[model samples]
Target: MLRWFLAVIGYLFFRFPGAIAGFVLGSLLDNMMGGKTRTFKTSFGPSPTVSPADFELHLLSLASLVIKADGSVSQSELDYVRQYFVQAYGKDRANETFRVFNEVIKKREISAQNICNLLRQRTRYESRLQILHFLFSIASADGRVSEPEVNEIRRMAGYLGVYSQDFESIKAMFFKNPDSAYQILEIDRNATDAQVKDAYRTMAKKYHPDKLQHLDEAHRKGGEEKFKKVQEAYDQIKKERGI
Candidate 1:
């Protein structure tokens, strides 16, 4: 039934590039509904069981939501989103994904919380964490994350079941401040030097990019960026305390 539906969509859009987009979107929808079914076949084996394409769509949708959290989206936010797509999926695929992204952005009625819930249902914790990180990046693209944007992100995090501490840690990575370093390390400012060292080691182990090896390249890269921030925050705290 799914394949037949896709065939009809392909025929209807036969004269337009949307035919390809329809196919990809339909495949993703089928995967979401069918679960574990192979959407593509190859001589090498099977295509990556996890769909980066679907994940990319969710990421862009969330980004659009974050960009519009302040009641309007900026050119800088749009440009950053475009550059993110180009970097992750290359120019050709990015252009294709951008079409879907625009449609999502146009639907201002759709709740960001709803999108986050769907992501939570369909994705793993690590993948959802990466999505949150990307959303923070989008919100901060205009030099700072607005209060509304931060509130929306926090609400989305709660809906996604991301621990409050982890959400704050990810937020601190993009919006740095003196106290943000402590947040990133998940430690108290008044903690003893020994306790601070222990917290840093624990955070280092928890955020190590190696833990995300099972995910796709884009997610692995996100994890690596997060891990670097964790290290930087720990170093900053150590320097401040002269530990």
Candidate 2:
């Protein structure tokens, strides 16, 4: 569909004033639909691609991955995400991102593979990673780790062609112990027993698996694993800290 539209636009551009009329119409449509036109160099023919709505869906899914990583989404986390949009694409683009995000949140089902194809076509690795990191940062925006958000990150990661080991390494950069704790939990090494207990109580309530069991089975499975890991991490911290 994308190729067809581009071919029609190109032919019209070279063929007649009628093409100019198409350009005006297309521009208006593009503005209304959230699309940007760009020239591509292809040996065989036009690139196989879908519409900008598809791209918006893809990016919005990635954003949700961040918000849902631990188990629950918070207002602070959402604010961080909006700030990310402002930093990366400005307020206008951010508003479009939020619209797409709202649509995804209401979706019945979504696939990361679909997102992968869109990202492969529309973005380079650095760009995609930046988006992913932005999502990660948002998950921890409230200065704590939520289990659901982490699980979402793991499930959606495969579609990005990121190896699990490599992804863990990147994850380590954000979360303190990719194995035991979330990076945002940020419990100090020398904290008092009371502080450790307080931290554990906060995290325990945050990652309760039951809260997210209603998600799709696959999603629930991932959530369970992350919740277990969170529990394990918190326990280890307690044992060491004698809290």
Candidate 3:
């Protein structure tokens, strides 16, 4: 059904006002087909054959896939999306961003290949950076950085215009080794028992999903798992110190 619909719309490009009609028809199909995204006010702006606004909605929808593929999506992952959205674009766009993002995730309609192609066409520079960071955000969101999530993020980075050299830097920096519990807690592994406990407390408060508005169910689940690890790590260290 989706394929036939997509092909039909693709053909409509030459038969009618492709840009205006195609965008509207595709968006309606997306809604009916359960496409996850927010509607933006289409302007007379001649940017690209594809719509940047529409592409961002799809990007975020695809991003949630990276986050949830491994059965988890963390507070860190959601946090990164929010931050990257603001940094790359701004709050207003980010607001529209969440609308489509959570919508797609809720519906679970993800097409990696199609999304990658669309992003390649529409985004660059900071928009591209937002995509890469959103992937890293998913990898790091769970704190422990599961291998599956890392691999998914890498695939996503490839789509997002992250070149090999930059990707290497990101891999080395974020996925090179298993992140330590101390790392999650943002403290020294060698810290005295009390300091480690303090860091854990701080992180727990900081990453609590309730504190993050608009966080989806998947992200909340991931946050709970990460929080569990933080708690366990601190407790284990305290036990060793007999404190």
Candidate 4:
């Protein structure tokens, strides 16, 4: 399905060469997915089995893509990725992964669309949201999220099938515009107090840490932080509305 879809899209855009490229990417996806019957059990539920090594490599590729999106790579951003892996996977494993990432993954030309497509197929929606949040955190490691980085992440959100509202909500967390609280709650500023409360409840459920039990410890920590952000957004809304 992915191959055919990409092939048609490639044909439409770049004709023969585009079609060939799309087909090649499609084949890569096929190999990554392997057998359809494969499954892995997790706390949240069962998901398609994507080997941990492969998943890590693709994830690192995505990280590298984001780090380089704004023309210059920030040491802070690179350090953030390293520290995150160290915290999540422990020192030895993090170092090993970083070795491969630096020597192999970071040097490659990655297709963000291809990586996102694989993740969209293999991972849950909530997991993808966490991934986006992590990417934003990386982008903001140097204390500012550049426009180019935001744009790249937004394109990733589209490929990952994350809703626009959800994307904006995550973006708001890192950007802090006037309507940020409302954006985090996924409601409009004009929403009534009751509507705001309802949105909070919905977002709370969406970002609840329990939903990410299937993920690794690092991601679970991320989910908990996201849940806290939702609560904080709600609190801010309530204070403004005197609710």
Model 3 scores a TM of 0.45
Error of 4 at 112 (Å): 0.8
Local distance difference test, each candidate: 0.77, 0.56, 0.59, 0.87
How far off is model 4, as Cα RMSD?
10.0
- Which is superior by lDDT, 1 or 4? 4
lDDT digits (tens) for residues 1-243 of candidate 2:
333464478666676555556666676666765544432222234554445445555666776666655556678877775665566456886688778667766776666667765565554343344344445666667886566766677666666655565355335545654343533234655666777677666645544456444232433443454455556666776666565
- Give stretches of model 2 more than 4 Å off: 1-35, 38-57, 100-108, 177-243
Q: Which runs of model 1 end up more than 4 angstroms from their true locations?
A: 1-51, 103-108
lDDT of 4 by residue, 1-243 (tens): 788888889999999999999998998897767763334343356656777766777777888888998999999999999888888878998888878877875466679999998888888888899999999999999999999999999999999899999999999999777799999999999999889988999999999999888777998998998999999899988888889
Q: Give the Cα error of residue 158 in candidate 1, in Å.
A: 1.0
- Comparing 1 with 4 on TM-score, the higher-scoring candidate is 4
User: How high a TM-score does candidate 1 get?
Assistant: 0.74
TM-score of each: 0.74, 0.49, 0.45, 0.80
The segments of candidate 4 whose C-alpha lies over 4 angstroms from its true place after superposition are 1-47
> In terms of lDDT, which candidate is stronger, 1 or 3?
1
| Models ranked on TM-score | 4, 1, 2, 3
Clashing pairs in 1: none
Model 1 error, position 26 (Å): 18
